[model samples]
Target: MSLLDFDADQLAAFAAEVRQDYDVLKDKDLKLDLTRGKPAAEQLDLADALLELPGKGNHHAADGTDVRNYGNLAGLADVRGIWAELLGVELEQIYAGDSSSLNIMFDLVSWAYAFGTNDSERPWKDEETVKWICPVPGYDRHFTITEKFGFEMISVPMLEDGPDLNAIQELVKDPQVKGMWVVPVFSNPTGVTTSEEIARGLAEMETAAPDFRIVWDNAYAVHTLTDEFPPVHDVLGFAEAAGNPNRFWYLTSTSKITHAGAGVSFFASSVDNLDWYKSVASVRGIGPNKVNQLAHARYFGDADGVREVMRKHADILAPKFTKVLEILEERLGQYEVARWTEPKGGYFISLDVIDGTASRVVELAKEAGIALTGAGSSFPLKQDPNNRNIRLAPSLPPVAEVTAAMDGVATCVLLAAVEKLGA
Candidate 1:
């Protein structure tokens, strides 16, 4: 029988049994973390080339600019060219920004609030209350950024294809709705891809605020586990075709691909947006770390080189992801109390338990020494009204440990679901 229709009482009993087993199996009082979606030590080994600078002997860019000296506010042309190839945009349209994409995102918000985009008339901060559409079961960090800036975040529903376009169209009609955050490829925690139809709809959408943009953070663009990965629809091209050239602010980084804290990030947009961003970024700093950009350019010479690197990551990650899925199937699949996403190429597996039981399940897991991303973190303002979504990051731990942790999580889920039903 499917987990959705299993007997709650039977599931409860199994949970108790599993908890007993876990208690006995684990002897040491070791503190293990599965809260953050960080790369494991083995995964970090894949970026060893980045440790040494590529052109220490030679320091000039293709445009005759010194790589060591910092003056290219828009970043080195070759680095931008490489990132553009990876992001599927024109070379002139890409901006090789600093190490953090988050910083770039922050700057975009600042610019929109203060000066507004070229297409829009009024600044967002001048409005009574600015708002943003945050698809539910999304990246927590995205929501955090919006919340920090005091934007009223409206939670839009997310499906396998992407954010509900019907809701998005309706929300954008309100002048307060400025933007939406999307992780189109193997989205965080859910590991689902947005459909082409939704991509087209978003590109073609009409908003009361002309400055309405989609913050497309493709952090896992190249991190796929399977051979048949979903292709990212060319949203920028679609938007331009639909006469909405300024509708997207695409951001990506080699953080997960290389080093988390020290990787170069890229921003892609229309020529208009690029010019606006460059003018604003000039005031912020001279330029991002060219040495790091050179390192990335050397490591992944082109789009094909990045793909080759991702294949290595898949080798390490695929087995771990499969192990977690298998353990979850063996333990909770029989119970029918929850359902989960079987992602082909992302760092997360999203599990949905019976409504209102997520917090209890997470609490139980914590008591048993297994930590998880908070229950409501997937939603805006840390509020999941149904309290049903749970993000499982299985990549950080070793295979054996991941298996054990998943088993522990299953026990907690079953226990919580059964108790909720009993009450």
Candidate 2:
């Protein structure tokens, strides 16, 4: 039965029982973390062959450019082409860079702030106030970037299909709303894939800001948990068809695919947008890390190679996800105090606890030596209006650890919910 069905005495009894369970959890002196979605050591080991890749004299790219020396700002065609095919964009439309798609995103925002985008009448810094649309229970890092730049982040509810289009369309009517962030496929935490209908709506929406760019961060486009991978949507094409050819800025990286800190990043958009970015990028540095890009190229010979490696990752990851879901269901099912997304892809599972108890749940978990992503982290400025929503990252921990951590977490959830009820 739902916890709501419990009377005061019954709820207090249950709370006492849950507190005993929590005491036992703390007694175990366990130190388990579910903070960030880092690849497990075993998952990293799958790409160990990359260490000796592009060995010695194999320094030249297929285009006859020496990767050892500087200046292929566009990166190696072999690697670029591989991602191009995988991302469903043309090779020339995409450019590869050293790891960290976040860095590329930062530069784009920074550059726009300093020099303005191709369509910007003036640099963003000149604006009276720059606002950004953020999908709630979205990626924290994405919000961090805009927050750091002092942009007023407006939160929109993330529906099952995607970010609320009706809300976004209304928000963008303001000229100061410069851009928005989107993890198009298997979005962080929520795992809500942007339906093609939503994708087209975003691309075609009439934003007052002529240069209203959408940061299409497809971080988990290929990181599937099932046998079937989600399709890479033609977002740029959607923009082009809508007469806004440069409406979206596409980005992806092999950080999770290969070595997290030593993989290649990619950017794709209109030819004009690509050239404009390079114009700014050219002044910043000589080129990207071609040697490392070539090494990645050698590691994943082509697009299929990436899929094969991801499959190996799925093999290791699927069970951990299943375990987490099983624990959440088994422990919290009867009470109905919580509900979590059973994601098909992506690195996180979003959990919604009883309103006003998420922070308490996280606190209880921490006191019991379990680390979870901070409560309200999925919202703008670290504020969840309802004080619910927790992002659970199961990718970093082993299956056994995931089980223990989740069980302990469930106890905290129940305890917090009961405490909120009885108080």
Candidate 3:
């Protein structure tokens, strides 16, 4: 029955029962975390070969450049080629760096503020009011980078097709709205890939700022958990066709694919944007970690090898995600007190509970020794206006632990609902 069907006395009795159940949970001393999309140990084990990789005497890059030496700032040529086949970009458009693409993102925004991008009339910091669009229930880290730059963040709804492009187009009509952060494929915390239609629209849309950019973080491009994974299509072609070749700068990494801190990062863009980025990046160093990139190229061999490893990851992750979903359904389905996204390919399942109860649910989970992503993390500045959305990261824990964590979480959801309804 729906939670609304219960009368005051029933709710009170049910709430009391839930309280007792929670007390039992607290005493159990469980220490489980469902807080981040970190890979499990065994998952990390899949890339163990990278440790001794390029093995002895295989230190030369594909083009015969000594990878151990400085220079080749664009990174190993073959490494870029591997990602080129996957991202559908020409190799010249791609630049590989060290492990964290998040670093690349921060650098881009930071440099753009000081030196400005190719089309900018002046540095972003010079603007009277710098603004950016953030898709709600989106990646918190993405929001943090832009927010740290002091940009006025405008939150728009992130639908299954992607961020509300209509809202984004309208927002960019203001010259101060300098850019947007996007995860075009298998977006963070939602797993919804932006449709080709949306991608095309973004490429063609009019903006008041000539330097407006789309910082596309396709982090989950190969992190598919199922077969329905959609490739992010021809964004560059569409942008060029729309006469806005400078509109998007794409960032990606193999952090989740291989060792989290040891994989290579990539940034792809138009020639002009890339040239500008290189000019600003030249002072940082002569090159990135080519040793890591060389290790990756030797490990994967090609695009096909990358996909094979991802399939192994799916074998490990698919079950944990399934267990979490099964528990959520079995516990909360009958009550109709919640709804959630069953993602085909990303690291998270976005859950929504009855209004005003999300923070209470998270608090209850914590008291029972289970940790979850904070309730409002999906929104810009961690504020969920409706207090409903919850991002469940089922990727880190083992399958059995995921089952336990979700059970605790479901109970907390019920307890919070009962308290709020007062029956």
Candidate 4:
């Protein structure tokens, strides 16, 4: 039963009880953090062998290219082949880069702003207005990138399958809407994988902008909580079949698979798009870190090697995620004042509190020394219209810490809801 269904006196009594719990939480002096979806220490340990990988004086790739020297702007074939198999792209379509896929994403947008895309009639910087479609409760860093470039961000709700395609289809009718960002599989916070129907819609949809692009950031492509890996859609191929070969910019990284800071990044796209990217990228630098690519290539001898590593990551992470979800249900299930995702994969659980109490809940949690991702963090511009959503990250903390943090968080949510109800 919902706390809303309780009588005035019942509500008041519940409020008092929750207040007591909150006070006790504060008194416990807990210093727990549930902020970022970073891999835990244990998860990192699984890839420790990479620290001494490719051994000393072993500097050649399978093709006998000297990895010690620069100029494989495309990266090692073995490395690209491994990721190509994993990401469902052809070997020729993928470009393995340095550690950060975010860097590659930023460069794509920046390059478009400066030089336009392969299909662009003019540079985005020269446009009268550059608008972007951002799925709400989406990735903050993605929004930050567009925000920095001064693109007008249009928000659309994220559905169980993916971003609201109806809304997106309408938004793209204007030529100013240059692009959109999508995580595709096990999206951030919500863990809503884009179904094939939605993926096809995104691929087949018509847009007024000749250079409209989709930055498909598959950051968690292989980060599954289950034994089975999620399907990797052939989005680039979908676009090609839809006669929009240049519509998608596919990206993925081994950041979570290996070392977050030192893993390899990948970019795959149409031949024209790749040509366009290389034209400018070559001017910027001689090549990516081929030696590090060699290390990662040597570390994961094949695609299955990457999957085995992820399975180990799953073993470490699944328990922490389970604990958080269980605690959320045990503590807040009866009240019906909140809802959260039970993600099978990905690093976050999207929690929606009472219509306007999310900020209050976060504040109460902070006062009790439990740090959470800020309120409305999952939305564009850090603004959730209802002030209701919170992203809970359980991947970084240990299971016990996740339990404590989530329990404390539940108390905060109850307290905030009761106070908002005038109890």
The digit string of per-residue lDDT tens for model 3 on 1-423 reads: 888898778777888988898888889899999989899998999999999988788889868988888998889888999998899999988999999999999999999999888899998888898999998789999999887988899999999899999999899889899999889888888888899999999999999999999998999998888754567687988999999999998999999999998899999999899899899899987889888899999899999899999999999999988898899899999999999888888799999999998998999899899998999998888899999988999888888889889999998999888888875
Q: How much RMSD separates candidate 4 from the native structure?
A: 0.7
Model with the higher lDDT, candidate 3 or 4: 4
Worst 10 residues of 2 by lDDT: 414-423
Off by more than 4 A, model 3: none
* lDDT of predicted model 1: 0.83
Q: How would you encode candidate 2's per-residue C-alpha lDDT over 284-333 as one tens digit per residue?
A: 99999998988899999999999999999999899999999999999999
CA-only RMSD, every prediction: 2.1, 0.8, 1.0, 0.7
Query: Per-prediction TM-score, please?
Result: 0.94, 0.99, 0.98, 0.99
Q: What is the lDDT of candidate 2?
A: 0.93
Across 1-423, the per-residue lDDT of candidate 1 in tens digits comes to 654454766556655775566565345443555688888889899998788866558666667777788787778777788777777788877888778898899889889888888776787778899899998899999999889889999988888788899999999999878899999989987888888899999999889888889999988888899765468678899999999999999998888888888988899999999899888888878888887787788778877888888888899999989988897788778767788999988799899998999999888778778889999989988889999999988888998888778877877786676577662
Full-model lDDT for every candidate: 0.83, 0.93, 0.90, 0.92
What stretches of model 4 exceed 4 Å from their correct place?
none
Better of 1 and 4 by lDDT: 4
Kindly give the stretch of ten consecutive residues in candidate 1 with the minimal lDDT sum.
24-33
lDDT of 4 by residue, 1-423 (tens): 799999999999999999888888999999999999999989889888988978898989989998888798888997999999998889889999999999999999999999899899999999999999999789999999999999999999899999999999999999999999999889998999999999999999999998999999999999999899999999999999999999999999999888898989999999889999999999999998888898898888999998988888999999998998888888889889999999889899999999999999899999999999999888778989999999999888888888889999999999999999999
